[model samples]
Target: MRITKVKYKDALIQALLFIYLIFTVYPVFLMVITALKTNAEIIKHPLSMPIKLNFSGFIKIFTTQNFALYFRNSFFVTVLSILITVFVSILLSYALARYKMKYVNPLSIYFLAGMMIPIRLGVLYINELLNTLNLIDSLIGLILVYTAMTIPFSMFIFMGFIKMVPVELDESAYIDGCSERKILFRIIAPLIKPAVATVTIYNFVPIWNDVYFPLIFIHSPEKKTLLLAVTIFFGQFQTDWSLVFSALTVATIPVLTIYLVGSKYFIRGLTSGALKG
Candidate 1:
């Protein structure tokens, strides 16, 4: 009877998970179906299957919109943000983990405070800073903003992994005449790969998908990101539902592909980093 109850509970959990997956995928299914339908067909039955496959929306966006430029900007910014965040987080985590410094904990809290507050809250200040630096509508400006914004979370994840490493390793290396910098770069830096993967995946997605900052901060036609580029599919007089869906479909595929490729590494890293004890 107890075994039967356990089976039933497991079945219940599986059913719930399946339902959640469907709920998550329903929007994607809707978007794909709408993208395949004519705007009139979409209006008639918003949830119904497409009567005919539509390719004009796809053609219109690629031919008419600044899709290529937007794609380039987003790709450049996300990659650069990854580089900056990883470098800074790894170095900062190493110091906090190994060094005996006064105010180390408080200092970490100070770095982490940025995570709680939205950077948009300081738009006035950011605008002034950007204007003074003459960074308006520049991809470099976007990259810097995303890198600085993503650092807190990356630092936190790296710090968690670094804490799990034993100090004895560092001490042994020091005894062998390794300098402080040498020990940091060579001895204790490798065990945190999983945390690094987790941090990268976590930070990359939001940066890729962010639209508000790109819209407000960028005005130049050439500097649009993928999310902002999708806005071109919408018009004041007439919104092309099918084209909008198609643009979203185009924009979403790359991020989803990255997540799928990275999730395996990210989860493996998290489990190894946290459950090793």
Candidate 2:
């Protein structure tokens, strides 16, 4: 009787999960199909499959609308931002995790405070700072903003992982004459791959999809990111449904690809606790 009861409960849980999966994926499934339909077909049958696949939206955006530029800009910003954030965060987190300094707790609280407040709340200050630095309307300016915005969260992740790693390893390396840099880069760094992957994917999504920062800071058409550049398809009187869907689909591909590539590390990172013995 207990075995039968357990089987029934398992079956119920599986059924609920399957339903949730469908609910999650249904919208993306709709968008891809709609991207293949013409505007007329979409207006007539919003959810119906296309009579014939139309690649015009994809082609036109790439050929005439300078979509490649947006893709390149977003790619450059996201990659550079992640690199800077990770480099700064890992080192800071290593200090916080390994050192017993007087100001360590205070420094942790500072990053915690940053995490508590939304970074967007200080956009005006960021803009002024960027302008003072003469990085306004520049990709480098955008990269700096994204880097600053993500550092606190990335530091938090790194701190957790670095803390889980036993300090005895550091002591052993030090006794063996490994320099501080060598201890960090050669000893501790290899053990924290999961944390690196987690930070990369977590920061990648927001920086890639962000339109608010680009809309405010970037004025030149050449510097606009993918989400910002896609806005041209919208009009006051009529919107291009097909093109919008196509642009959205194109914008979504890199995000999904990154997530898929790092998904194993991401999952393991979340489930595993630092470098616990």
Candidate 3:
């Protein structure tokens, strides 16, 4: 009787999960189908599959609408921001994890406190500072803002992983004449791959999809990121539903590819980091 009940419960859970998966994937499926239809076809057969695939909309976006430029700008900003955020966050989190100082707890709180504060709340001051530094309308300005915003959360992840690392390893390395830098990079860094992956995945999606900061900080057409470009494209082609869907599909591909490729690491990192923390 107990075995039967357990089997029934497992079946129920699987059924629910299958339903949820369909719900989650249906919209993305719809987007891709719509992207393949023409505007007339979309209006007449909104729920039906396209009679034939269309690449014209995708071509127009790349060739005529300058989505390639947006792609480049977004790629540059996301990559640079991740590199800077990860580098700084690892060092800061390592110190917070390994060291024993009176102020360490307070400092950790100070960094985590940033997560509680919204970036938008500081935009006025940030803009003013950037203006003073002559960084307005610049890719560097966007990268700086993204790095600052991402670091706090990334640091939290790193700290969790660092705490889970055995302190004995650090002591052993030190005994072998490994300097603090060597201990951090050569010793501790390798053990926290999951945390690093978690941090990268977590920060990448938000930075890649963000339109608000870019809208506020960037005015140059050539410097606009993919999301900003999509917003602008939508405004210009409000009546062209097919074109809009194509642009959105194009914009989504890179993010989906990144996530799919790193999904294993992403999941492993989160689970390990959470358990270790």
Q: Where does candidate 3 clash, by residue pair?
A: none
Question: How many Å off is the CA of 169 in candidate 3?
Answer: 2.1
Report the CA-based lDDT of candidate 1 relative to the real structure. 0.82
Better of 1 and 3 by TM-score: 3
Backbone clashes for every candidate come to 0, 0, 0
Ten-residue segment with the worst summed lDDT in candidate 1? Answer: 268-277
Q: Model 1, 38: alpha-carbon shift in Å?
A: 3.1
Predicted structure with the largest lDDT when compared to the true one: 3
lDDT (0-100) at residue 95 of candidate 3?
89
CA displacement after TM-score superposition, residue 180 of candidate 1 (Å): 3.8
TM-score of each: 0.85, 0.89, 0.90
Q: Which residue runs does candidate 3 get wrong by more than 4 Å?
A: 1-16, 264-277
Residue range 249-273, candidate 3, lDDT tens digits:
9989988987899988667655653
Better of 2 and 3 by TM-score: 3
